[model samples]
Target: MHRLELDGITKQYPAVRANDGVSLRVKPGEIHAVLGENGAGKSTLMKVIYGAVQPDAGTIRWNGSPVTVRSPAEARALGISMVYQHFSLFDTLTAAENVWLGLDKAMKLPEVTRRITEVAHTYGLDVDPQRPVHTLSVGERQRVEIVRALLTDPQLLILDEPTSVLTPQAVDKLFVTLRQLAERGTSILYISHKLDEIRSLCHHCTVLRGGKVTGEVDPTQESNASLSRLMIGAEPPQLQHGTRPAGDVVLAVKGLSLAREDQFGVDLKDIGFDVRAGEIVGVAGVSGNGQQELMAALSGEDTRSPAGSIRLFGRDIAHHGARKRRHEGLHFVPEERLGRGAVPTLSLAQNTLLTRTEAVSRAGWIPSGRVTALADTIIRRFNVKAGGPGAAAKSLSGGNLQKFIVGREIDADPKLLVVSQPTWGVDVGAAALIRGELLKLRDAGCALLVVSEELDELFEISDRLIVIAQGRVSPSIPVAEATIEKIGEWMSGLWAPRETA
Candidate 1:
């Protein structure tokens, strides 16, 4: 029997038809990939299947019988579970507690913890069930979501952008886990914009573009170029990297250390780095290894460092606030887009007000026209898809939101730029465009610091690299000298200071 199927699915929003007559089928024990570009409606279709959103028109068939899925609880009861790209777990809860909350079957807290550990070990997920969700790395948190899904033993499993934050090694481990799940007769529906991953791991691929099905193919028989063409109607642009000449130091951090704010927080220890004008310095580590703390410190969100710790153009600014740093020609794009980087409830034009006062104001008076014009320029320059500047920040897709956030900072023309996970959850085309913009900025003499978990991205764009592990930063090395094995070892907190240097 077919494990899961959707026929003639359709959904509509105020501005667009999100999904139009979408149909898909997954056989038992098969890994099916849903491919699309940003705002292509892949997420909408999956949400319909998972009962997060009701379809305007459609039929869902499970085990060859038509059925109605009215809510997430209903879908879960029908042996379906989904792991979203954006996590839904509470930050303060333990992994076991989060998992227990999702489950329908009643069980003791100790029993739930035991099962979480057992399943994690069996699948090579390697998460500590007792660890608070806030304390776990991004990859470990993802494992908790996966383990929660596994506990349900769902007949159909759906995963959305599952590896965006994972390191290369973690991605491999996740693949093994998914393959094992598929072999055990659980049908899988995978959604991602990474064409290569889909081509390598999925048995069948369904392409979506602008809320419509573009094509379907056996991925094993298709090339990446062909799949890209099917999904986006064109090939993604290529990114070029070279050894750029460095200028004077623009941003420098020396002997920066901080005590943990929270009881479980990671205390930064002896972190030192420098970004020269016309240079890009990449800091790489698995998430939760002090990337958050470092970004906070660099962005002026946590300005409790000692005097002379952080310097901009040879001037100490350790006590400056975020607005003061921005006024001093420093710009930042944080990792979280929804609330931290951009406000969700605000319109795109209004969001620009968060940091673009100079661009849209004169002597403390807000110029409404200039604000709209600035937002319009950013939208056009970044190719952001939205309902003009009036659209709320939450209305855009993940990739589009990321583009807007990055573009907002880039347009400010700062002397120094600090960005974290610049392309997290973005599609390939958007990712390439964002990287191209960063390179252009670097060439234009803007110093840049990029903190990300993706090694390939760092190696491709960084002039120098550093590893952050357990709240400590390694000495910087040239990109040529940073090996994948060495970086992976550093991720585990194994590298000594001498080895890093």
Candidate 2:
């Protein structure tokens, strides 16, 4: 008998039919993958099954019996649990506290802590249960979500874009955990745009396109091109990389140091780097290793640095605000898309006010037409899938939102661009496109600083690389000289000290 099943599922929002006649079945001890492009209805279907959204038409079966999951709690009670793509975590709470809130059992705080640590170790997630969720990195917080789901001991597990924030090593560890869970009779429904991961880890695959099921097959038996065709109805564009010439220094930092703003935050010490015009400098580190703090300082979100610490085109702007820095020919694309990069409640055209105020405003009043025109340009340039410029930012998928954000900054023609996690949560093809755009920007005489956990991405586009560990920047090296082993060592603060003359 199938462990979990969905038949004739259909979901309708005011503007779109998110899912149409979607059906899926997962046998016991199987890992089933749902593959699709951004905004292809994968998330909507999963939300319907998890009771986060009510399907307009469909029947759900668990263990061969029709059931109605009216709420997430009801789904949990029915031995079904889902880990959402966008995390639902309280930043102020400890890991144990966050898990305890989702759990049904009447366990004490101490017991919850014990259980969290035990499960973390068992699954090789290695999270600190006592650590505050606010202090954790994106990858660590993702582990918390996974551990929370595992503690439920559910008969079926649904993971949505689970590895989007994880490092390559962490992804391998998660696959091991999932394989173990499947061996113990736990069925998994994995949703992701990463075709290689789906093919390697999943036994079965279902592809969706325009809110409809287009194909179902064994993932291991299908090529990447075949799967892309099923999901997008066409082949994704190829990403090409070429050697770009370098120019004069556009951004330079020397002896940059700052104390922690928060009581528990990491302090940056003696950080230094430089990026030349027409070159890309990539900063690589494991999540939580000062990347956030560094990005903030560079982006002018946290401009507490002393005078002369940071220089843009030989000008001291250590105390400048974000807007001032932007006016000084510096642009930034933040990591968090919803609340940081773009406001969730605002329409895409209105959200342009967040960064492109001058472009969309005249005589101190916002021009709706200019804003719409700019947003339309972003959509066309980045190939963002949305209803139109009037659509809410939250209506778009993570990948599409990322493209929009990056494209917005790149279109401004800044002298220096600092982007964090340029393609996080993007599909392979989209990721390639974004990287290619960054390289093109570099080739066009724009200095770029890219901070990402993806080693492959950094190595591919960066002319120079630096590893940030515990809020300190390591020595920078040319891409030709940097190796994965050496960079990984730097991530852990294990590199040799500078030699004395």
Candidate No. with top TM-score: 1
| Candidate 2 clashes between residue pairs 3 or more apart in a chain or in different chains | none
Worst 10 residues of 2 by lDDT: 492-501
Clashing pairs in 1: none
TM-score of each prediction: 0.96, 0.94
| Residue 263 local lDDT, model 1 | 64
Report RMSD (Å) for each prediction in the order shown: 1.8, 2.3
Q: Alpha carbon lDDT of residue 276, candidate 1?
A: 98
| Best-performing candidate as measured by lDDT | 1
lDDT of each: 0.87, 0.86
What lDDT, from 0 to 1, does candidate 1 have? 0.87
